[model samples]
Target: MTNAMWTHGVEWLTAATPDPRAGERAWLPGDGTVLMEAGRHWDLVSVPRQLGLLTLDILWYDPARTPGPTLVDSAAHRVGFLVPPDPAGDWSGEGVRHASRGAWVAVPPPHRTARSLEWIVPPDACTALHPPVTLRLALREAYETLAVLAPVC
Candidate 1:
């Protein structure tokens, strides 16, 4: 069976900040900003934003599955956005695998969870990273694709 687009009920979300030293700060984007179809959920895996030529990686929770309180790491899955490096190039299964290298953000589960790995983009690592503009466009397109894949009704 084809993958069913998830549209979960979201309550709150925290966005990335412009401050570099602040690392990650939690700020609720407010209630009801996210709307997914029944049995489906929206998880903000990563938000690609720039800060002084450096891109920041932000993680978000799906509104539909977020319980009344803090959702445990075990209960959460890292959502991902896949973009083709070459638009005209073949994007078959192999291409998808090759492009998935450092292109993803590693979010680990909690200690009570599996104690998975945790990785973040270092501030000095932007030099080796791709251009900010290109990454931004790719991320935007990925998000749009996610929205389309999600079932509205």
Candidate 2:
């Protein structure tokens, strides 16, 4: 992507925060990351990194379409998939959970990996949020691919 694309991607990430201006301000100073609220512009579906990576593999192989922005915190061993807020209702089950509404997540710049906060699937497009239904289907498929519905987190 071009510089414009990178800028737009960062814009996309910051705009979703609870305070967009502050998010922008933080980015301007090259801050490592900005804390953004979930369940407004988007909701975060948190899962174990192992399963989340499998889910991403499933999404990429779909041939139809891949999932959207995914935030990874290696320090936390977690991956947070950004999707429309609570679209499928309480996602917490087994190895899955979600942060909605007031919950905050550290959002990194699209083109940079700040510490353990980075994007496995960086936001590029204007509407980078994933479709909830597709994400659920992929999660199910990833579990099936593992050959066991076991908890990873």
Best by lDDT: 2
Cα displacement (angstroms), candidate 1, residue 61, comes to 27
TM-score of each: 0.24, 0.86
Q: What is the C-alpha lDDT of each candidate?
A: 0.25, 0.80
Candidate of highest TM-score:
2
Residues 49-130 of candidate 1 have per-residue lDDT tens digits of 2221121221222233211111212223322222223323332221121223223232221111224222232111111223
**Tens-digit per-residue lDDT, 98-152, candidate 2:** 8888788888888778888888888876544778778888888877777675657
| Residue pairs in collision within model 2 | none
Mark the regions of model 2 whose C-alpha exceeds 4 Å error after superposition. Answer: 148-153
Give model 1 RMSD, 1 decimal: 18.2
Model 2 sits at a Cα RMSD from the real structure of: 3.1
